[model samples]
Target: MSAPLLQIDDLSVTYWDRSLLGLRANGFEAVKRATLTVDAGQTLGLVGESGSGKSSIANALLGLVPPSGGTINFDGQDLATLRKGFPPEIRQKIQAVFQDPYSSLNPSMTVEEIVTEPLKVHTRMTRVERHEKAVELLKLVKLPETHLHRYPNEFSGGQRQRIAIATALALQPSLIVLDEPVSALDVSTQNQIINLLYERRDALGISYLLIAHDLALVHHISDRIAVMYLGHIVEEGPADRVYHQPAHPYTQALLEAVPLLDPARQRARRAERRGRVTTDMPRLSEKGCPFSGRCPHVMDRCTARMPPAFTVPDGGTARCFLLDDEPNEQGRSKD
Candidate 1:
């Protein structure tokens, strides 16, 4: 196997605050002891419900948020040890496409200017070369050259997202963080953007950290998936293994939450109603397993102690008490 392009070990991010009593307090712990690695030409999907620290992890990687603890190793260098902002070389190598397409791009800038901004800042390319490169990138993203002079406001949501994606590729980054890149678009448009992303990855040999909540889309695009609960990664493995045979209670619950179109299973599931699970998980302040309160398979230990991530088959890992001894494989029962 090739060396990891990015390796995050036990990365944790905490927000500090104080109460009215003039006492120090932890406002929120966005991420907790999470670890993952990404290699060149590979895509890793981080999936979870809102406030699960998916975005926090991405921000920490990009240096938008300083990690309170742990290390972020990129290209064998410690990111935390670097200067306040990223070194120009490192910054240009890791770009990002945020969630909101409508808000991500500046309305004041023309498509040509938007795409060429990075080159202007980082490259000594002349005006003519920058414009040429902008057109080339537009073509790479399937946008027409005629759209170069148009403003962001003139384009639809999907087009704007494509423009944002084009901007991200302007610097020729080796890795891109796509934070819910398609969640806001129409279903049909979502497919188009996803295809564009996949195509770019293939053509550029770039890696992706796809942060999303859509299970089906993640399943289709990711080689590996990490399931997060509250502020920690509760399960992670190859997409097939994590999707088909999830061992973590949170993973199982999330899979069951996906609506099934099959009439038979839908009817049975509706009748069962036992799976009408609440979406609520504990906050960062809560102790024990984050999913313990809502987990149907929660054990006594789950409520008293947080479960450690245990390795499983197909290079997978899950944090759940039920899988602790490898003997709790019996059918689901009361907690």
Candidate 2:
């Protein structure tokens, strides 16, 4: 197998909350030892709800947030080792498309200026060369040549996102961390952006670290899927297996929450309510499984102690007691 484009090992990040007494208190752990690998020319989908540490992981990888522990390896180099600053070679090899295009791009610059800025920083190309390259990049994203002169405000949401993507590609980066790249756009526009992403990947041999909450989009684009809950990855594997036979209860609940189109199947699935849950959810503690309080198949062991991630029968791994035979029987007895 080819060497992975990106490799993260035992990555963890935490925040310290100030106490009223001026004492230091640990705030919620934003991320916990997430290990994942994305091969060259592949897309790895990071799917989770808000507060699930999706953005935190992305920030850590981009060197925006320093990880408390663990290492982020990109293109066979450890990113954390370059604490002094980003190396020029690595900078040109990785780029980002943030969640909001409006905030990410410079409102003062025209579309041409925005797209060419990276090339200006990394390359010694002259004005004429830069403009020519910028136009080519815009064309790659299906933007009209006339739009190059317009500012960000002149374009619609989707168009602005396209510009952001074009700017990311300006550097000709091998890897792009797309944080909610299409969430801000309409459904129709979302499809357009997704198609553009795939087209760019195919044409440029770029890999993607796609972070989003949209399961449908993740399932469609990702070669592998990692599901995060609270601050940990509860389930991760082939997209088909994770979606079809989700071993983790949190994964099951999330899948259940998505609105399906089939009327009959939707009704049948929705009618069978799982179980009663309380509004006052449990806080994240060092002990026990994070999803224990919210899990329908939760066992006494879940709350009593931490559950080790176990390999499922078909494939993949899940951090839940439901997969443990002892806990499964114990949970069944409780049910």
Candidate 3:
């Protein structure tokens, strides 16, 4: 197989909290030993709850936050070694579309200026060429040429997001980091934007690191899915397998939380869930399984040491001992 367009190996991002006197205090690791890959022209959906370090990964990729450890190899170059924003050429190949379109786009700039800004910075295109390209990009996002002269405030939430996406595509970046691209829009608008992104990605042959809380929404577009909980990847595999046959307990709970369209099924699932008591997991330490506290099948050994990634039958890996070859009395690996 060919090398992936983006390869993240044991990536970690930590934030330090200092005292008022500039004394060293405590540090919080937002991402811990996270590893994943995205092939050229494919989407990798990263699904997790808020504060699960999804945005930290996005920021690390965009050079907004530096990696505390590990390497981020994008298109064969190590991003962690940059020490600053990615160089001009590398920056041009990696673009981002943020969650809030209202703030992501400069409210003062016209749509033409906003979309063409990347072209201005990355290319030697003339004003006329930039304007023409901006019009084309607007069309690509299903917006009108007339809207080119309008400001962001003049458009609806969905229109603003489309404009943001157009800006990201201006340079034809190989990878686009979408940080909750559709979470702010209404349901219909969210679907429209998702479809627009899918269309653009296929037409342009671009890769995406799509971050969202909605598993079903992400699953619809992603070729693979990775689940994050409290900064660690608990499960990852093909989207269909992860969605249909989640091997991790946390993944199962997340899928169950998605409200079903059928009322009877939804009620039945909810009733079944109520019978199980779940407690919030304790503060994550450097050792042991992160989901032990809340996991219904958690065993004594689960609290003693971190479980290795066990291969699941459905072409995925789950960070649980249930799949081990020789489980103990509490369903933990004897090893």
Instruction: Supply the global lDDT for candidate 2.
Output: 0.84
Q: Tell me the tens digit of each residue's lDDT in model 1 across 7-87.
A: 988889888788799786967788988998888888999999998999999998898988888888988788966648898
Q: Any idea how many clashes model 1 has?
A: 0
Q: Identify the superior model by lDDT, candidate 1 or candidate 3.
A: 3
TM-score of 3: 0.96
Q: On a 0 to 100 scale, what is the lDDT of residue 68 in model 3? A: 92
lDDT of 2 by residue, 299-326 (tens): 7777777666677777777877767777
The 10-residue segment of model 2 with minimum total lDDT is: 326-335
Clashing residue pairs in candidate 3, if any?
none
How big is the positional error of residue 80 in model 3, measured in Å on the Cα after superposition? 1.1
Sorting all predicted structures by lDDT, with the top scorer first, yields: 3, 1, 2
Residue runs of model 2 more than 4 Å from their true location after superposition: 18-27, 274-280, 325-335
Between the candidate structures 1 and 3, which one is better when assessed by TM-score? Answer: 3
Top lDDT model: 3
Could you give candidate 3's per-residue lDDT for residues 80-191 as a string of tens digits? 8889678998899999998998889898999999999999888999999998899899999999999999999999999999999999999999999999999999999999
Candidate 2 lDDT for residue 281: 76
TM-score of each: 0.92, 0.92, 0.96
Q: Give candidate 1 misplaced runs (Cα > 4 Å).
A: 18-24, 273-287, 326-335
